[model samples]
Target chain A: MSDGPAIETRGVTRVFESRKGFLFREKTRTEALKGVDLVVERGAIFGLLGPNGAGKTTFTKILSTLLLPTSGTALVLGHSVTKETAWLRPRMGLVLGGERGLYNRVSGRENLRYFADLYGVPIAERERRIGEVLERVGLTDAADRRTEEYSRGMKQKLHIARGILHRPEILFLDEPTIGLDPKSARETRKLIRSLVSDGVTIFLTTHYMFEAEELCPRIAILSRGRIVARDTLDGLRTLVGGDRTFEVEAYGFEDREIESLRHLPGVSKVASEEYGPATRLTMRVRTRETTLDDVRGLLPGHPELAVRERRTSLEDVYLDLVEEEAT
Target chain B: MAASAPAYTRARSTVASLRLAVLQFMADPQWLIPSMIAPVIFGLVSFELFRGYGPYFLIYAILGAGMMSMWGQTLYGSGWATGQDRNFGTLEPTIQSPTPYLYVVLGRVLWNVVSGLFGGLIVYAVVVGAAGQPPALANPLASIALFVFVMLTLAAIGVVFAAFYVYTRYAGFIQNIGEFAFYVGTGCMFPVVLLPFAVTPIALVFPPTWALDALRYVAIPGYTGFGWGLWGDVAGAVASTAVYLAIAGLIFRRVERQVLAKGNLSDY
Candidate 1:
């Protein structure tokens, strides 16, 4: 194995320019990537979590050699993305989200064969490889059907089959399960894990925090074109300093009740929302051992409130990180 | 691997691309049927209108319709292929592949020429069957040579059209206007001498004008092949083809760079 990282970036940035007016117009520039630096180790499933328009796709495009960075450099498998695209492209595969990427009028098998030929897979190996990937993605029965007849999930599976048709060392999956149903999404996740076990380094990006926590040992939270935090799940949980969130369900949540909860000794923040005749209150506190009792002590006077302690999940950590950036 | 390994690989890639292009074209009958029918209809109408002019007019109608069909297939087909790929969301992945994008695009245009030739042959069969006599060729060998050269020249121009289609939003409108312009400016339907004097320079610059004139000169009894003599017209067509091919190469490279920089390769 090589000592170098599978993928690395140093101060990568991308700026998109567009004209705004009808005739002679002013040029508007939007900085999509802000000197971002990242590294993905080989054989590791690294996840990048971000909301829409957070520059995740832009970074993926740069790494895949589909789009050039406006400045700085990115290397995939020790090859420069911009200068060595011809060398790098064959070694890396990118599967973008959405159902429209396939040739809808052709059968799934034909599409895979076309891509196999394009990637220059050995003619002798093409049929076996195509069959293997189709079966792996659980599309063998529908392989001969035209892609236009496929469901969204089936189309997504076909996308994955094409991406790995070359058997690339590094696979970049951008929101691979974006529109899949629950069962299909779970199946797709299993397929990704199997690919990783076969020693392909996966670089995944998704807005689903549970998906990331389930698949990735390490995750990076990106906000507004920048990576705000990167660490393992347990490491990120420590960012909140062992704080616990308690949910209080009640009726008629008055302003004074929320104020009282906020004034509690261990409480840091209290948020409340009303749904019809009922109200839900969330309290973020320093420690559950001391704060849970105190929260109960303060809540009993209301009589209408029921309190329960909740675990701090990765979703909470992600929202806190992104909300911090927004503020 | 041998020293010629890269060339061999490129040839294989080009062939695969051509297969895919042909398959896609065949699957879309809406595009193929109209392209084939337009030229045949034009030839039939021309033969009816000019029946008084003897067998020469029938030959003109056949060959002229064939040339016009080639232009329409090359220009409109190339542009629509790009648009369809973009709409189907396949352009990005195709561009992202390890093979050079130019081969994929040029391969598609080559197949379009092949299909256009097939369509032309159908028109020829109809005309010859209706007229009951083959058009006379003063120099059969030279006419055959010029036909090959003209097709190649037109194919190169098609490459240029493909590049513009890949890069521009107005590709459809441009293709429509371009096909009409080539039909009129190249004198596919009428002789250039009857056109305005101001239009003569524009008409002469297009290789297809010289190409059609050369074909008419050798095939018709009194036609004078652009008034440049046989060798002069042949040389002019060859030279202009080279120039157009060079321009196409440069344009393709420029547009490719712009598309990559702007991240608009798959935008519809």
Candidate 2:
């Protein structure tokens, strides 16, 4: 076992040069990844969550040694990411985006065998591992089919198989379930869990929060090339600083009632919406010993009110973080 | 078997990649099918028209058609295939793998050569049987040797063209140029003997030209029958093919490095 984290980055930056035209006069520089530091513990399912164009792919590329960072340093399994790529590449498997990473002309079996060889997998063990991965990814039946005829999901599964061919110490899956049906997406998540159980660490970048909530034990929210939050799902919930919000609908239409609820001691933010025949009010309040007690006390005054407390979820926390950043 | 050390892991991986390349070619019979048909089409319609001139015409057509098959299917075919791979970004996973880049390139080039050989044999059969003027082997063993050298040379040429496709982004242009060169240099319609002495020397420098004459001496009807010995043509073609192969190999390595350094391999 390694003493440090499976993946670690310190002030890593990846800058890409955009050269335009034949003469090469017009040049622009875009910083895809800017001085970012992160760490992933061994055997942990880590999620990198970010909006589109948030440099998640750039960060993943640098960490996987596919692209060299302009500045800063990253280490994968105690190997310098920038230097010693040949030694480092075999130990870390990567699944890039889209179906483009695979050879369409070969059968899935042959494709896997070819990649296995590139990873230096022994011949005797190659077939065994290939069989295991194909079955694990539910591609055993289609293994002999040419990849050109494979559907998007099948190609992605094969991509995953190729990534883990050499049993790399750490796996980097970028948008692994980007274009998959619900069933396939769930299966992919299950596969990730299975890999983690096998002691293979996973560092994944996904835009789907449910994926993060369902798969990643610890998640990092990357916004604008920086990590705004990195914690367990439960920790993120606490960090958002919002408690269970109740949306109450009452038949009685009264402005004074709304005013009184807004002035409650624990209520931090109040939002109101129309609920058919009644008014639906949502309050984001700090949880105190008497918070529910306070709501209960106010509810009795309005006889027509039907009070229901809504459970705060990961999505709610995510929206809160996004809205806070917007302000 | 007892457990062995991991020294041969890389070699096994290279072989596996080569197998994958072969699998890719086999998976798409459409690619090979057309290459097989092109040579026959040229042989039937074009080669027959040139037969009245001399035995040299029939032999030249046969050899030219054979070279065309290899140059078109192997060299130009590899160019188009590699271009497609680059456009699709399939090279990313390949380059990222631990296998040396040279093995990757060689595996792909070898696949082209295999396809080219198949195409050459099919064309050779059509030209010899259909034209009713098959060229005899000047020295059967030497002819076989020349075929090996010539195919290797053509495969190397294919590597160079594949590299060029990475930069041009239009591999079809290479295929067109290759087809034209096949017709002109190999004297498929006009034998180099019809050209002036100065032009003959220049045309003879092309691999296909040398290959056409060599095949004619051994496989076709003209050269060995006319006092030009089989060994002379075989040796000359072999030397020229060797030189072409060496240059092609250098170009393949150079372009590969440039493509990797510029990160243009993934460019569509």
Candidate 2 to truth, TM: 0.81
**Which ranges of candidate 2 are over 4 A from the true structure?**
A16-30, A97-100, A148-151, A243-286, A290-311, A323-327, B1-11, B87-89, B164-267
What is the per-residue lDDT of model 1 for residues A48-142, given as tens digits with 9 covering 90 to 100? 99989999999998999889899988998888998887777777788995978888888899999888877888888889999999999999999
Q: Local error of candidate 1 at A250, Å?
A: 3.7
Report the number of the highest-DockQ candidate: 1
Candidate 1 CAPRI assessment class? acceptable
Each candidate's lDDT (Cα)?
Answer: 0.80, 0.72
At residue A147, candidate 2 shows an lDDT of 87
Could you tell me the TM-score of candidate 1? 0.91
Candidate 1 wrongly placed segments (more than 4 Å): A20-28, A251-281, A284-291, B1-8, B140-145
For candidate 1, the per-residue lDDT at A122 reads 81
Q: Write the per-residue lDDT of candidate 2 for residues B47-137, one digit (tens) a residue.
A: 7665676645655566566666676666666667667767667777876776655566567767677777777677778877876656655
The 10 consecutive residues of candidate 2 chain A with the worst lDDT sum are: A284-293
